[model samples]
Target: MLAANIRTQLEAYLQKLEQPIELAASLDDGAKSAELRELLREIASLSPKITLREDGADARKPSFTVGAAGQAARVAFAGIPMGHEFTSLVLALLQAGGYPPKVDAATIEQIRNLKGELRFETFISLSCHNCPDVVQALNLMAVLNPGVTSTMIDGALFQGEVESRKIMAVPTVFVNGEAFGQGRMTLEEILAKVDTGAAAREAEKIGAKEAFDVLVVGGGPAGAAAAIYAARKGIRTGVVAERFGGQVLDTMGIENLISIPQTDGPKLARALEAHVAEYEVDVMNLQRAEALEPAGDDGLARVKLAGGATLKARTVILATGARWREMNVPGEREYRGAGVAYCPHCDGPLFKGKRVAVIGGGNSGVEAAIDLAGVVAHVTLLEFDGKLRADAVLQAKLKSLPNVSVIVNAQTTEVTGDGGKMSGLVFKDRVSGEEKQLELEGVFVQIGLLPNTDWLKGTVALSPRGEIEVDARGQTSVPGVFAAGDATTTPYKQIVIAMGEGAKASLSAFDHLIRSSAPAAQPEKLAA
Candidate 1:
């Protein structure tokens, strides 16, 4: 809080310098060097307060040895800090630079009366640029209470270190340096990592960010509904819509979006988007969050992203929508986010007036064909069966579309594309047994989408297909990270169902947020 240790000045310094030549276009050689040194100087100034009182500075196995006042500092996080996490990086550096923020005096008073040692060591990789926020949040938590110290280690830099400790994800945290209590955690959730419930209760204090109480992941109906309710409660709220409208966006027409007579994916997604935006909730489109970890127990949970940006919240609701089943073909892997897209609604706009193909013969396929017909110059609907398996109405509707071509009894043998994006597909006729090729601009693989849980890394239980395993209340096997939507073992992957699941999960997150602060959970920080 000292004027010399002002965090804002250090933040501004970090904002300007970072191997500047690569970030900025033109810079004189000497100027760049001067900037780099200045940044390093600022970095060096951050007090090297070791987390958990490590023993030596070898960087080889973190030990509990005593050392001189200055040394290389460690940073930690349990989530990929991609999207909005960029802000957290400066804060973490400031905390490392011996300048803890000038928060309310009451907050510091709480830190001074701590009883035992508490350490939050976050494991992250630079590629997971989003890990910094989680790291910074933990740092803030540490400064709030002197008893707690945080350290961050690059997961890749210390592969052996993380492996020996059994880390499956890039950004993971180990409170008190213990191997137990795994999974992404929020600030309040991390406080549960301690042994004594009483001290944690004493540590309880409301934070500004908690007003956006819970972060509902996924932009599906469930996620949207959760955001609405949380916001309605005057609890701050936000929704990370990786795929806005969940499976709904891929839908052709929804007779099922609550009281609506009929709705299309784009129409429904737009409506939901507008509805959620009506609230003060922060609706971040085109963003993703990889993992969850403890930010601090200041009653506000810090959510980390893939790019190293982070946000603080009272709780989080994971509605991270689902994706279609990938054919896993040769080019499919290379051209994933390229010409190969999953949502017809999201990527469909990109393919306006271009040739495209829709894989799958089910309701989704028929729906995609009908939907793409309006956007693309031509749409080739491929189905393995001789007849359309979708409802008669949809089949007639798809057939009615002039530019849409339904290829019954045909399957895609190969997705041939150039460099990285899709150009066309090689198909085989099932009845005539003839191979054919079709030129196209994009391929919307709507065959079927699995939950987007592959990155979850088995930290929590998953279905046979690798979807996150969740109990009835949206609780995963892990304590802090919750799952919802098609990612769980939920029955139907419909818009209505996914939305319901998202809302349910949000409620569950709220319940956990309330329970995590109970006295029984406040374990002694000295526990092994």
Candidate 2:
């Protein structure tokens, strides 16, 4: 069950265990159960402080609990926690064995102070890169607080539960048997949801912060680069991000990042965060900028957050990146997380052996179809154009898939669902002037991206497509304000391009700060 190199590494990791821990497994007479037994045995043999007990009676068979010996287990796994979740399993074992977590002291105390007996179950796919964050977060919470319990359930292994609960997305979280959230969620975001007063307290603390020399909004590659460049100049740099990683978190394989031969989105996002942390940049995560105010008489721009906090800066670089563009057809929003998903890499396993449609014939759509072909029964790729826009190599690979069908000149009309979950997709045959419907269980939208500039509609000068308009120097129409990355009018929305744009925008903002000499405007002179 375990490779030799992996076993050696596991043994090294287990040496960090400070207390005795038990793996209480409840399994039946199945192949998966046998595999789990062998894996547990191999794990137990690595550490003297570890033990395995198979006489368990968990409601979910083939599951195991990890906790200190003689104590009630609070962390469990209902399936093999390998693939992207391998790190999650390692952390769970270490934390259960009295090893400290990487979370901050305040967050640890907050988790321990939670009052209710909250049980969290996270449904995940082994192939999903985003599931580990949620799984590790909940597992840590359970380890810290005796009142909390978290279980990571593999959706592919537990097909019955996935179908019965109508789960069509990865990282779908349920608390005490009710839906809590879906998609990639950070640990702070989860805490904010359960702790009602957390948002208000955070807003108050942020509102009282001092003004910055450079304030970069968004935390994607562009925002991170801008922050790094500004901080390197010895200016007080600050970054306010809604999620920090932006669209990169949803990406999977990446072979064209320049210099680096290959890397995934989540891995690159982590590297970006770590690189930015090396500087003296004040990063405030999970904060959305609602409105931007141009430089007033004080020569300081103001950014108002959704949480009622206002951040002031001498120059503001808007790097708020783009999001997955939706079809905007009927029933799409109604059944977004329920059979309508944007990420095939994350949600494809949930639709195993089911019929699904991939909207658009671009590179993303074709790639998604090719990837889903192995897991799903069939895939219908729809394109609005007469031919596919993907590269020749991708289109050839897509055509080679037997379970995939490509339909050109097809416009997605409406997504049909059965109120609770999606059932089919409606499209129009452009050439024949006829309408058609494909009976499917899932619809993956992969058209493109829409810039996150809705809030700057009236405040900043935007193109017709809603992207921020900027000059060659990354300077926006508003003085002392700049924009970069996918949110601006920069062509080619690639990670490498976004970083270059960000560095340019930060330099432009710095230049604007040093050249301008103006007095603070009166209260009456400000825009309403």
Candidate 3:
């Protein structure tokens, strides 16, 4: 109910008193002047809310409180919030107009395990409009939860405060006195980190609903993509995964994806998972799905969690990506990152100009051989089969590299390494029945990949290898069920492809919803 000019009025009152009076000189001045000063003082006392304090060299500390509820909900700007940030800051404060952030079902679920507070402070230049959707998104997050605050401090106006915090960037953010986020954000990422704050504070009040709509069983590219799209589409999505990001998260760099020239898998996954908050997707980290069941006519399905909770979904999008098949040989597990690697695209740079080996001669193996030959001093390609299963074009490419030599009909029974890194491999020639050893700095295994659809049972159609079977549009055999990314029998497992599939499935599900309602299937006529 306050007017917009109140700040101007208060500032006018304070500025008028800027005149100085020396303590030494007593201006036991005129009665008229004294009477006027007393009248102004009495008028100020009418409010009974104004107080004087010293801060800066003048010892001036200018803080004024007027809300009936006191200063419970405060937007303290140590510096001015100007430029594009001005509107965002005002909107954020108005949205979170009450104390703490608002708490919603989705927001509460993530913060149920929270036991502490997170104070987030974002430093921004008045000019960083490229910052993106986080400011408003963060305000919405605070509105849904308690004890979470989002503030955008204009670093330029408050140089002293900025210097005290050692701020070096335009949009640097801090959570609990440490950095939470920087640069542009899409709301969900900000919520993700803040929810982590809520989770830490209210660790015991999570609630009764543990289930979710889209139970993304894994946390790889596909699962993360599915969660993001489903949440955005207003689906009551929940993610149950052993981890947040799957094997791709372990990757060092991803250059093949579009838009971004290069990014580490873990960083990308973190950003993507944060994007899930756009529509309130619930995430159950460190948990796994154990089973699934058809919901019959409801067109919905039920997924059983490892912790015994059941999730219901009108439509299920299977995005539980795939992983590399392991060697299971001695020293293989022990020296994985050191010497044994699954994806050359992830770790090839570490072996530059040094001897390396590519295990298996399938498409993946050949591709790895070709990629590694560009960086390594030598590459020995091994295959247990009689010949390479790679395409003729790729096979020619691999052979063209002088550093890469292919060995067919080879079997590796053991691996030996040092200092948690691999150094050599012992193999047996399957055709000649002779054993041989190769010394190398790195080894890229590309035998095959296993889809993570083992727990899906026979509730849905699946490929022979247990990959979920879905149509080109990511639809499963069931009407409401959909599948996407690597879990499905899709040809490619790239990040962009997974995200594209996720969005397509969400749109398809929305279309299906528009149909099958009580009003029947009446299509609206187009406007002339």
Candidate 4:
């Protein structure tokens, strides 16, 4: 069931185990259980230090326990552990075998000094790319603190529990029986939430109220750059972002960014935050911008957040980025994170040595094909257009890859998969009436980009395609307001370009401040 290379990696990781670990599975009599047990047995055969045990049948749901010999298991996973979640399972096993947590000293100290019992119940899906980070962090915390117990609940496996808890997304974390967080979060961020009693407060009421000389409205590369540049000026700068990394978080391999030969999304995101932290910028994360109010006569613009908090600023820089376009085909939503993935950088590892397909013929799609070809067994690139729209250089690179194949004038009809996971895709030939099916394990959709400018519709001027309109200096249609990055009418949506635009916008805002504050040329007293 495992690829030769992936199995080699797993074997190496297991060899580092400090002690023997057991996998206890509680499963019902069904095909899913059969498949899971088969996979577990294969994993067990990989290393003599590992073993598997059945915990009897359970009609409600399936669960698994990971622990060393003669020790009660404090870590459990309740799901299939497929797709991206496979990484979570591997990391949990390592933790059970005495792999120390990779957290900083301060965070480890906080976990060690905790006085009361804390249980982290993280709801997840096999397909979620960001879920593994939270799961691994929580599992490490459980290993560090005897008072903490962590469990990974596959949201799809326990439907009743998920509905009872009102979970609508993966990586929904609960602490001490209270909803703690949702989506990708760092270990420090989770600790802060727990310390501040944030879980007890209504989700919509949790935010900070502040005023700033400059406020950035997104957390992607552009927003982070703007915040850093603004703070360097020694002003009271602030940034409010839904997620600090923006689309960069979704990118897999970033090779075009100057100087940085190769880096992934999460790494770049952390670097962006580290740079911003060097200044006095007040970063409020996981806060979505609800509305943008233009500066009044007092020259203070107000930004309303979804969490019912308002931030007032002398200048506002809009760096809200773009999201990947979806195909809107059947089974796309049902198998999201399972077989349908958007960010190749986040989910590519899961499909190592496996066959996958990419939808689109543009630069993003061709680039994804080229990248995946190096890791996966094969990459099938499908384009709806009559001809490939990517640059000649990219097309040549794609053609040279033996594992990569391009298909044009192909219209994807449906994403076919089992009730639980995606199996393949069906597409129709636009030129002929022929239909074809490609049996692949994963699909990367890179058709196009859609700006995250819905909230700025009436607040700012937008181009026909919904991108923010900005001048060369990054100034928006409204004075004291500026925009940059993918959200703007920029020709390219690249990390370096976004960072440069952000710098330009912040400098423009600074210039506007200086010019507006300067005393207007005094009118002649005689004229008065």
Candidate 5:
């Protein structure tokens, strides 16, 4: 149940309910069901507008639905929505009670105008920080649209269902009984997937926009900094990103951010977004850049998008950041969501009581092994190097775990699976040229990161490793076009470094703009 302070907060929040809400429970004689009943009772006691009923028809026991009184419930939870999902429960209650959500008006109208019925079931682990976004997004859609229904199912609580579906990742979403997507996704991304013509519409709208003074090609720490800095200079700034937070959303704990003692990825990402919002930067989320063109004779650089949209700007900053490096072994891609995972903190709970392997011997790998050892039955860490490259303290902690075993000089050959899910993997002993196999239910890859600069291959100067070549001032080989963050030749891939580089790139772009002989062109204003 909730603590004393949380109860007080919940009581205050319930005051915002504009309509009476009902909590219908489908329960069994299990301990989880008892706990859920207590939680429901506590919630019902907080507000006069709330009612709890034990009679329910859901096939999944220990489940419940929240909706406006006398209305068909569209939002349900098959497990106790605690931990990261606690906020999701609160939001579901409020939204179901006719309390308006914090989404933009355009998005609200789009959800309401959706065509067909959508039944969404999201499987998640309570410990996963990324799960709440997916859960809350679906809940919002269900609340806004009568044709949509969403269910948040705890994979750990429903072990049989998870195993039967061969789900090995948190936040795996199923729509209409078929796999929809897996991983951290925003509401816009989900809408894009379901709305077939959305991309074309967005592309047309974006193509009609005027050129920006400074265009940031990412929305991570670097791109956020660039946008803020450019906007502060009274320039028309814009940001295009696949996701607003980039890889930082997938990150778990971030303790090394200066001045702040501790914070997590999602928390930090939200802060970054809020900070950027303080300026006049136009942030276009869920937009991917496909290609980059240097400044033409008209004094503007062009960035093409995968959705057929092209944006022109006086200056462009490439801060696309990086992504997790995957093991190139066979079956890795096929069983990615089923058994092969990259984020240990997000997917570790799904492999509880099952044997797993952590690939790599670096800090991330050792750290993953140490974390997985606490939840999994056993952890086998395979390192391609001759010795562990983790910090001394991390190595010490990893060595202390009895259930974790380390294998140095081992290269992952192939991820062995049962055609549907991963059952094990094969590795080669580099020293002896011998092959070894270990039976495991999950494989957590923690090798390293690959720069997200594949699109800029021949467009910009790049290093041998595919990183954009940037000078001291963050200026790339092309004039008026700069690069920053993990996608560039930055020595360190730290968040702090990326922010500084972004600022520098923006300043350099501004300098380039001022030094040009051509006069600044007045942008065409569009009707709002």
Candidate 6:
């Protein structure tokens, strides 16, 4: 059954609909089908302009074709779209009912002018917060371009297809039957994959020149910030990232970014790219930096990308960022996308009214518990330490929530799950030597972060924990090279902190450029 609050929200959105939308559902006879049909009926009933037709047992599983009256079905939702994906369903209905997309004109133009057929099949879980962004983006693109069509497949219901595709994560997108990317992605990123010719043309333009005044590695918040700051200085700046937004793409709700009260990870990531786009930064996305070579006195620092393209720069700023620490328990890997999730923000909604557990007693774990408590029915936070390590303020906030409970001196022993999905978690009391099992649908692991500095092992001075060693000004051990964000020895790993560090690192790199023997150029004019 739909939550009252969510139903209210959906009704409000439906009231704004100007055109009629037709939803043709192909459902088999089962409890899952019955539930999905009821949910659709509820949604259709809310809006006088919406219509639902039962196609009956035509598909192997529950599927629906959504479009305006007399129009070809341009969008499809396969499986139940609940949890975080409810938003996607609502958005799809809105767009089908004559609501325009919110994409930038540039991206829209790109989509409008796209050639060839693009079939995007996005496999997603109802609980995944990140999946909605990608799904909505692709859905909008499909609406904008006749050449493109997208289907949102519920990974949970379509277990056979999920297994056949070997989808290990939510929001696993396939472009033309090939895996494009897993996790959250922006509209621009999706377009880049569909328009291969455009990407190659852009790459050829960048490959013609190999040197830059400042080359900022990574595309997360720190790297994006660094590239923008460096490019604003009128220098030839370039950025190489396997994907823009780095670890920030995996994040969900960001409330402490200053000024902005609250923003999700995908929105913030798009904003970061939008800000960088205002400048002349040469952004090379989908490129990985395999190795880094320090400048030999007179020569520029060389960065070797996985594509064999070598970028030479007078100054290099490392902002690769970090990844989440895994618990390494049994079934943790077996059921990654199934039930064991590391991001509470992305997957919390999926477990609505269901019991869940949060591992680790740090600020992240406490914050996750506090957040999940609001969305889920109950939250059990397990800490390995004798006492929680989170700040007193956070601890107090977590204590104030009635739905959340904290368990200390407990070590997660195993993530017990059915072959297809997670069922519960097994834990052991460190001191009491007692084992316990918590029946929960989801588990969020917020133990800690591991910096993405493994590739820079011998090239730079790294801390014992593998973070790049940097001074206050963001200067690394090597001259003309700087590091910032979670990848560095920065104490805190907040978004605002990473942005500040990125700016500092860019300024430091600029200072090094001016003091060095490189050609002197006016600050107002960009290097040619």
Per-model clash counts, in order, read 65, 3, 27, 2, 0, 2
* Colliding residue pairs in candidate 2: 297-520, 297-521, 298-520
20 in model 5: Cα distance from truth in Å?
A: 0.7
Cα RMSD (Å) between model 5 and the true structure? Answer: 2.5
Tens-digit lDDT string for candidate 3 (45-117)? 4333333121212111121111112234322333333445545543443343332343456654554444456
C-alpha RMSD of candidate 6: 5.7
lDDT for model 2: 0.92
Best of the two (4, 6) by TM-score: 6
Error of 3 at 495 (Å): 2.6
Top candidate on lDDT is: 2
TM-score, each model?
Answer: 0.48, 0.97, 0.51, 0.68, 0.97, 0.76
On a 0 to 1 TM-score scale, where does candidate 5 land against the true structure? 0.97
lDDT of 1 at 11: 45
- How do the residues 1-528 of candidate 5 rate in per-residue lDDT, one tens digit apiece? 789999999999999999999999999999999999999999999999999999998989899999999999999999999999999999999999888899889999999999898999999999999999999999999999999999999999999999888888989999999999999888999999998989889999999888988999999999999998888777788999999988899888899999998999998999999999998888888889999988888888899999899999989999999998988879999899889999888899999999999998999999999989999999999999899999999999998899999999999999988789999999999999999999999999999999999998888989998999999999989998998899988898999999999999998887777677432433222101
Candidate 1: residue 15 Cα off by (Å): 45
- After superposition, candidate 4 runs with Cα above 4 Å error: 1-132, 143-147, 150-184, 188-208, 348-355, 370-379, 391-405, 417-419, 433-441, 518-528
lDDT of 5 at 117: 88
Q: Candidate 1: where is the Cα deviation over 4 Å?
A: 1-213, 234-253, 263-287, 294-302, 311-315, 331-357, 370-380, 385-387, 396-410, 417-424, 428-444, 514-528
* Over 4 Å off, model 2: 517-528
Per-residue accuracy of model 6 over 53-112 as CA lDDT, tens digit each:
997343646888788877877788888877777778888899888887776687778889
Whole-model lDDT, model 1: 0.60
